[model samples]
Target: MIKVSEALAIVAENSSNMPVQRIPVRKALGYILAETLYSPIDMPPFRQSAMDGYAFIHSEKHQYDVISTSQAGDHSNIKLNENEAVRIFTGAFVPKNADTVVMQEHVLANKDSILIAAMPPQFSNIRNKGEQIAKEEVVFEANTLITPAAIGFLACLGITEITVYKKPKVAILVTGNELVKPGKKLPKGKIYESNSVMLEAALQTIGINKTKVYKVKDNLKATKKALKGILEKYDVVLISGGISVGDYDFVKDALLANGVEELFYKINQKPGKPMFFGSKKDTLVFALPGNPASSLTNFYIYVYPAIKNRMGFSDIHLPKLVRKLNDPITNTTGKTLFLKALYDETNVTILDGQASSMLNTFAIANSLLIVPDDVEGLKKGQLVTLLPIN
Candidate 1:
């Protein structure tokens, strides 16, 4: 068995970014930019009005002639003389020679002219060309994540598409003979199969929607055949059972038969000690324990980061923090413990049902307290590492 940190290092070393592809900016949310993007044009390419008011050349006069009206998306070339104002709405292109704008509420309107009740400063309420960002300036660097606001900002610049790393093609295989699908009658000695859907939903949370699930019986022949076929096409394969040394377990032997290079077999951690990570050619494989809690914990710790790394994310691990423990705890098993907990700003409370087979605690947990193997016990007020999760 290897230490948790060593396993993480191995995964990081093996995971590589996927190929780059140009996609529509609207569809690029949550994707990592594959190239540095430069602003094609100045933001607010022309002088724009910042409010729905009158635009005119600055003068000390309290009265002005209303020349014309300009709203958003208008290309009026109206010019303004001294003490002359034009009715302009927000986001409208301000006419040339206009240097000031006053809110309509601050002016007394007449039939064809307005009297300024409040004389504002020169060049007020006007967004100069490139005020936000200049043309050819770096808008986003390579590896920056695409967010909703990013898409809207790029759209304002008339950018239709952007280059980003493609998400991985993943395949999940659930192996066991005693597992039955949900909504079906369970046999006397069988349990419902849920890891496949649970893992699929977890992948979806990270915007990985292209995934297929397969079922393989607890037999070497079937496991080998399934592995061979999936490895040929997918970039990542997740096996959710049959890795232990039980008589029915066949994933480990099947993976070897399929010629996968084992990078690591197990980690010195509780709830997910029997995890397996390996690769063959370009395809990465992870075999997690059959238990639901163990399977999900290993996914968060190992598989999630690997997938994010392959998608070109620099920050691939779960968001972590340090918080005081609400109660004391002990680790007599001498293994790193991933305890499900509820955390606020200052403290974390470890919940019950830390068993590998139960997910009740995980369902309500907002974070996972990582207790290192070297630590034998912790006091109520001691600080510990916490990983925030959904």
Candidate 2:
């Protein structure tokens, strides 16, 4: 019965990074960079205009005449001298001997000559070459998650492709002879299978869109056969609803018989104490509790971090927010409890009917209120830790 933090450390230390794969920039969002990206060329590689103005030498005061017009992508072999200025539009390259730009509104322009109405500051409105970024600089570091902003930055550096970590394949399995699929009428004493679909959607939110789902009956032979066959095909296997102390609870025994080394079982947490974890041939397996709230909590507290670590993310925890409790709540004194909560600007209110079997509580919860194991109860207006759900 190790603490949750201790168990997390163990799992993180054991997980390995995924293999690197080359992907186009458009498809690299949410993937982790496997290699450092260096800039091949300078940003704004040449001197250009920062505004629509006249480019001229600052040393030549208000007495200057418009010599030639320069627009973007204009590589005209034009030169400037004293008392001469170029009609420069935005992003046009500054001609030689022009070190300053005067806005059109600040100057009086006639047919041939232009008069500076005000004194233009030195280097004003002139965008220098390589001012934004220098060549050969490290733009994106290795192991960084590729976000939309990161992808845009890479594209700005002319990077069309990048090396990123491959996504892990997760296999979701649901067990119960009385369980039936959704959209079909269930017989008496039967319920629609939901753990598999919920877990599949949850995994997709964490950037793992590829998953294999299997629904097995509550039988040792069928469960064992499914586990043995799928263990080799996926990096992580998630089995729901067969780890409790029932006559048909055979997940733990089957894994042991098949040579899977148990890492830990029966955590001291509420709603998910019967959860189990094990490994065999580099494939990780998690036996989640059957209840909807327990399964969701187990995924957030354990499985999510495991998958994130393998994807090259260094920080695998959700962001925490500080909030005041809106109502008092009581819990057992020896096991940590994660209560489904809804938090806004003023207060965080625990959802009613927090039992493991309640699914509606989870649907409205935007955060989880983390109650310590030794605490018995909380009072209204007391500050508590809130973990936001993505």
Candidate 3:
């Protein structure tokens, strides 16, 4: 078994970025930019009115003759003379000779002229061309995460398409005879399967939607066949259950039989110590514990980062924070503990029902309090490392 840090390092070393694809910018939210992007034209491309007002050449005057009326999206070429003004709406192009704007509410309008209520500053309501971003300026560097704001910004700059690292194709193979699909009648000792659905939603939260699920019995041959088929078609395979040394557990054997080289079999971590990480060529595999809490915890701590790294993200791990503990907690297991907890910005509280099989606490958890193996426990008010989850 390896330490948690060692396991993470191994995952990082094995993960590689996916191939790049040019996709429409509108569909690129949450993807990693594959190439540096520069603005093709200045943002706002032309001088623009920031508000509905009178645009005019600045002069010390109580009134001005209205030359023309302009609304948003209009390209007005009417140049203003001294004391000349245009009735302009927000987003309208500011004529070249205009240097100031006065709110319509502040001006009293007569037939064709308006009286200014007070003097306005020059360039007060004008958004200068290239004020937000200049033409040919670097928009974003490679590996930048495409957020909604980024998409809007790119759209405003007239960028229709962007190159981004393609999301990975993933497969989930649930292995266990005791597990049955949800909504099915419960056979004496069988439990409704949940790891697949839980994993599917978890992957979607990270922007990965290309996934398929397979069910495999505890039989070694069935497990091997299922693993073989999924390994050939997916970039990553998440196998739940059948990884421990129990007589019915056959995932390890199946993986080895199919040429998956074990990089690390387990880690010194609670709830998920039976986890397995291996690779067969470019395909990565993670055989997680059968327990619900354990499976989901391992997915966030290990599998999530691996998938993100493969999608070209440099910051692949969960968002972290150093927050104070709201309550006391002990880790007598001598293994690194991942405790499901709730947290505000200041402090975290470890919740009840932390057993590996019970997911009650995990359902409400917004963060995972990480207790290192070297430490036996922590007291109330002591600061601890936390990994925030959705």
Candidate 4:
């Protein structure tokens, strides 16, 4: 067995990148940018009016002749002379030699001229050229995740398509003879398999879709055949059950026989110590424990980071913070423990039913309280690191 850090390092070294694809910028939200993006031209492309008012040279004059009116999209060449003003609306092009604009409310209207109620400062109501973005400026770097605001910025630059990291194709193989699908009649000594659905939901939460699920009996031949097929297709393979050292455990042997190089077999972590990770070429393989909670926990801790790194994500790990424990907790498993807990502003409350086979604690928990292997227990009000799930 390896330490949790060592297991994570191995996962980091084993991840593989999917090919980049050029996608329409409108449909690229949540995808990582594969290339650096630069603005093609100055944002706004012209000096624009920031508000509805008069456009003229700022001076001490009390009145000016109203030459013409300029609204948005009025590109007619209009130059302002001394003591002359143009009635401009919001987003309209500011006329040449116009240095200021006073609000309409600040000016008294006259038939052919306008009287200034207040003197306006120079360039007061104009959005200067390239104020938002300069031409050829690097606005977004590679590996940056595209958000709604990024889409708008790209549209302003006239960029309709962008190169982004392609999402990985995933395949899940749930192995167990006594496992039955949900909504089916449960026979004796059988439990409804949940690792597949839990894993599917976890993947989607991280913006990863395009997943397929398969089931196989606990037979070595069948497991080997299933593993081989999935390995050939999917970039990431998540297999639940048949990983521990049990009589029916056959996933490890099948993976090894199918040329999946073992990166590490076990980690010094409670709930998911039997987890196994390997890879063949650009494909990553994870053999998670059969327990529902263990599989999901391992996915969040190990699998999620690897997938994110492959998709050109820089912040691959979940956010972590230190919080005081509401109550004392003990760890007797001689491994690092991940306790399901609810976190408020200052403290975290550990929930019950933390057994690997149980999912009740996780349903209501928003964070995982980390209990290091060196610590025997934590006293009330003691600080511990926590990772949020929501």
Q: Tens digits of per-residue lDDT for model 1 on 283-387?
A: 999999999999999999999999999999989999989999999999998999999999998999999999999988899999889999999999999999999
The sequence of per-residue lDDT tens digits that candidate 3 reaches over residues 1-390 is: 999999999999999999999999999998999999999999878888888989988878878999799888888579888978999999898888898888888899987999999777877988999999999999999999999999999999889999999888999999887888889899998899999999999999989876899998889998988888899999999999999999999999999999999999989999799999999999999999999999999999999999999999988999888899988888888899999999887888989998999988899999898999989979999999999997
Q: All models: lDDT?
A: 0.93, 0.87, 0.92, 0.91
lDDT of 1 at 349: 98
CA shift of 104, model 2, Å:
4.8
Residue 206, model 2, lDDT: 81
User: By TM-score, highest first, what's the ranking?
Assistant: 1, 3, 4, 2
Best by TM-score: 1
The residue-level lDDT of candidate 3 at 79 comes to 80
Instruction: Write candidate 2's Cα lDDT for 1-390 as tens digits.
Output: 767766777777666788889999999988989998889988878888998989998884787988899999887777888889999999998996788998888988898888889867889998887887889988878889898998888898889999998888899989888898899988999988899888989998889987989888888998888888888788889999999999999888888877788888888777677888888877888999998889989998889989998898878877789899999978765888888899998799998878998889798799889888888999999999988885
lDDT of 2 at 165: 87
Score every model by TM-score. 0.97, 0.91, 0.96, 0.95
Clashing pairs in 4: none
All candidates in order of lDDT, best leading: 1, 3, 4, 2
Clashes of each: 0, 0, 0, 0
- Worst 10-residue lDDT window for candidate 2 reads 1-10
TM-score between model 3 and native: 0.96
Error (Å) of candidate 2 at residue 320 is 2.4
- TM-score comparison, 2 vs 3, better candidate: 3
* Error of model 2, residue 331, in angstroms: 2.5
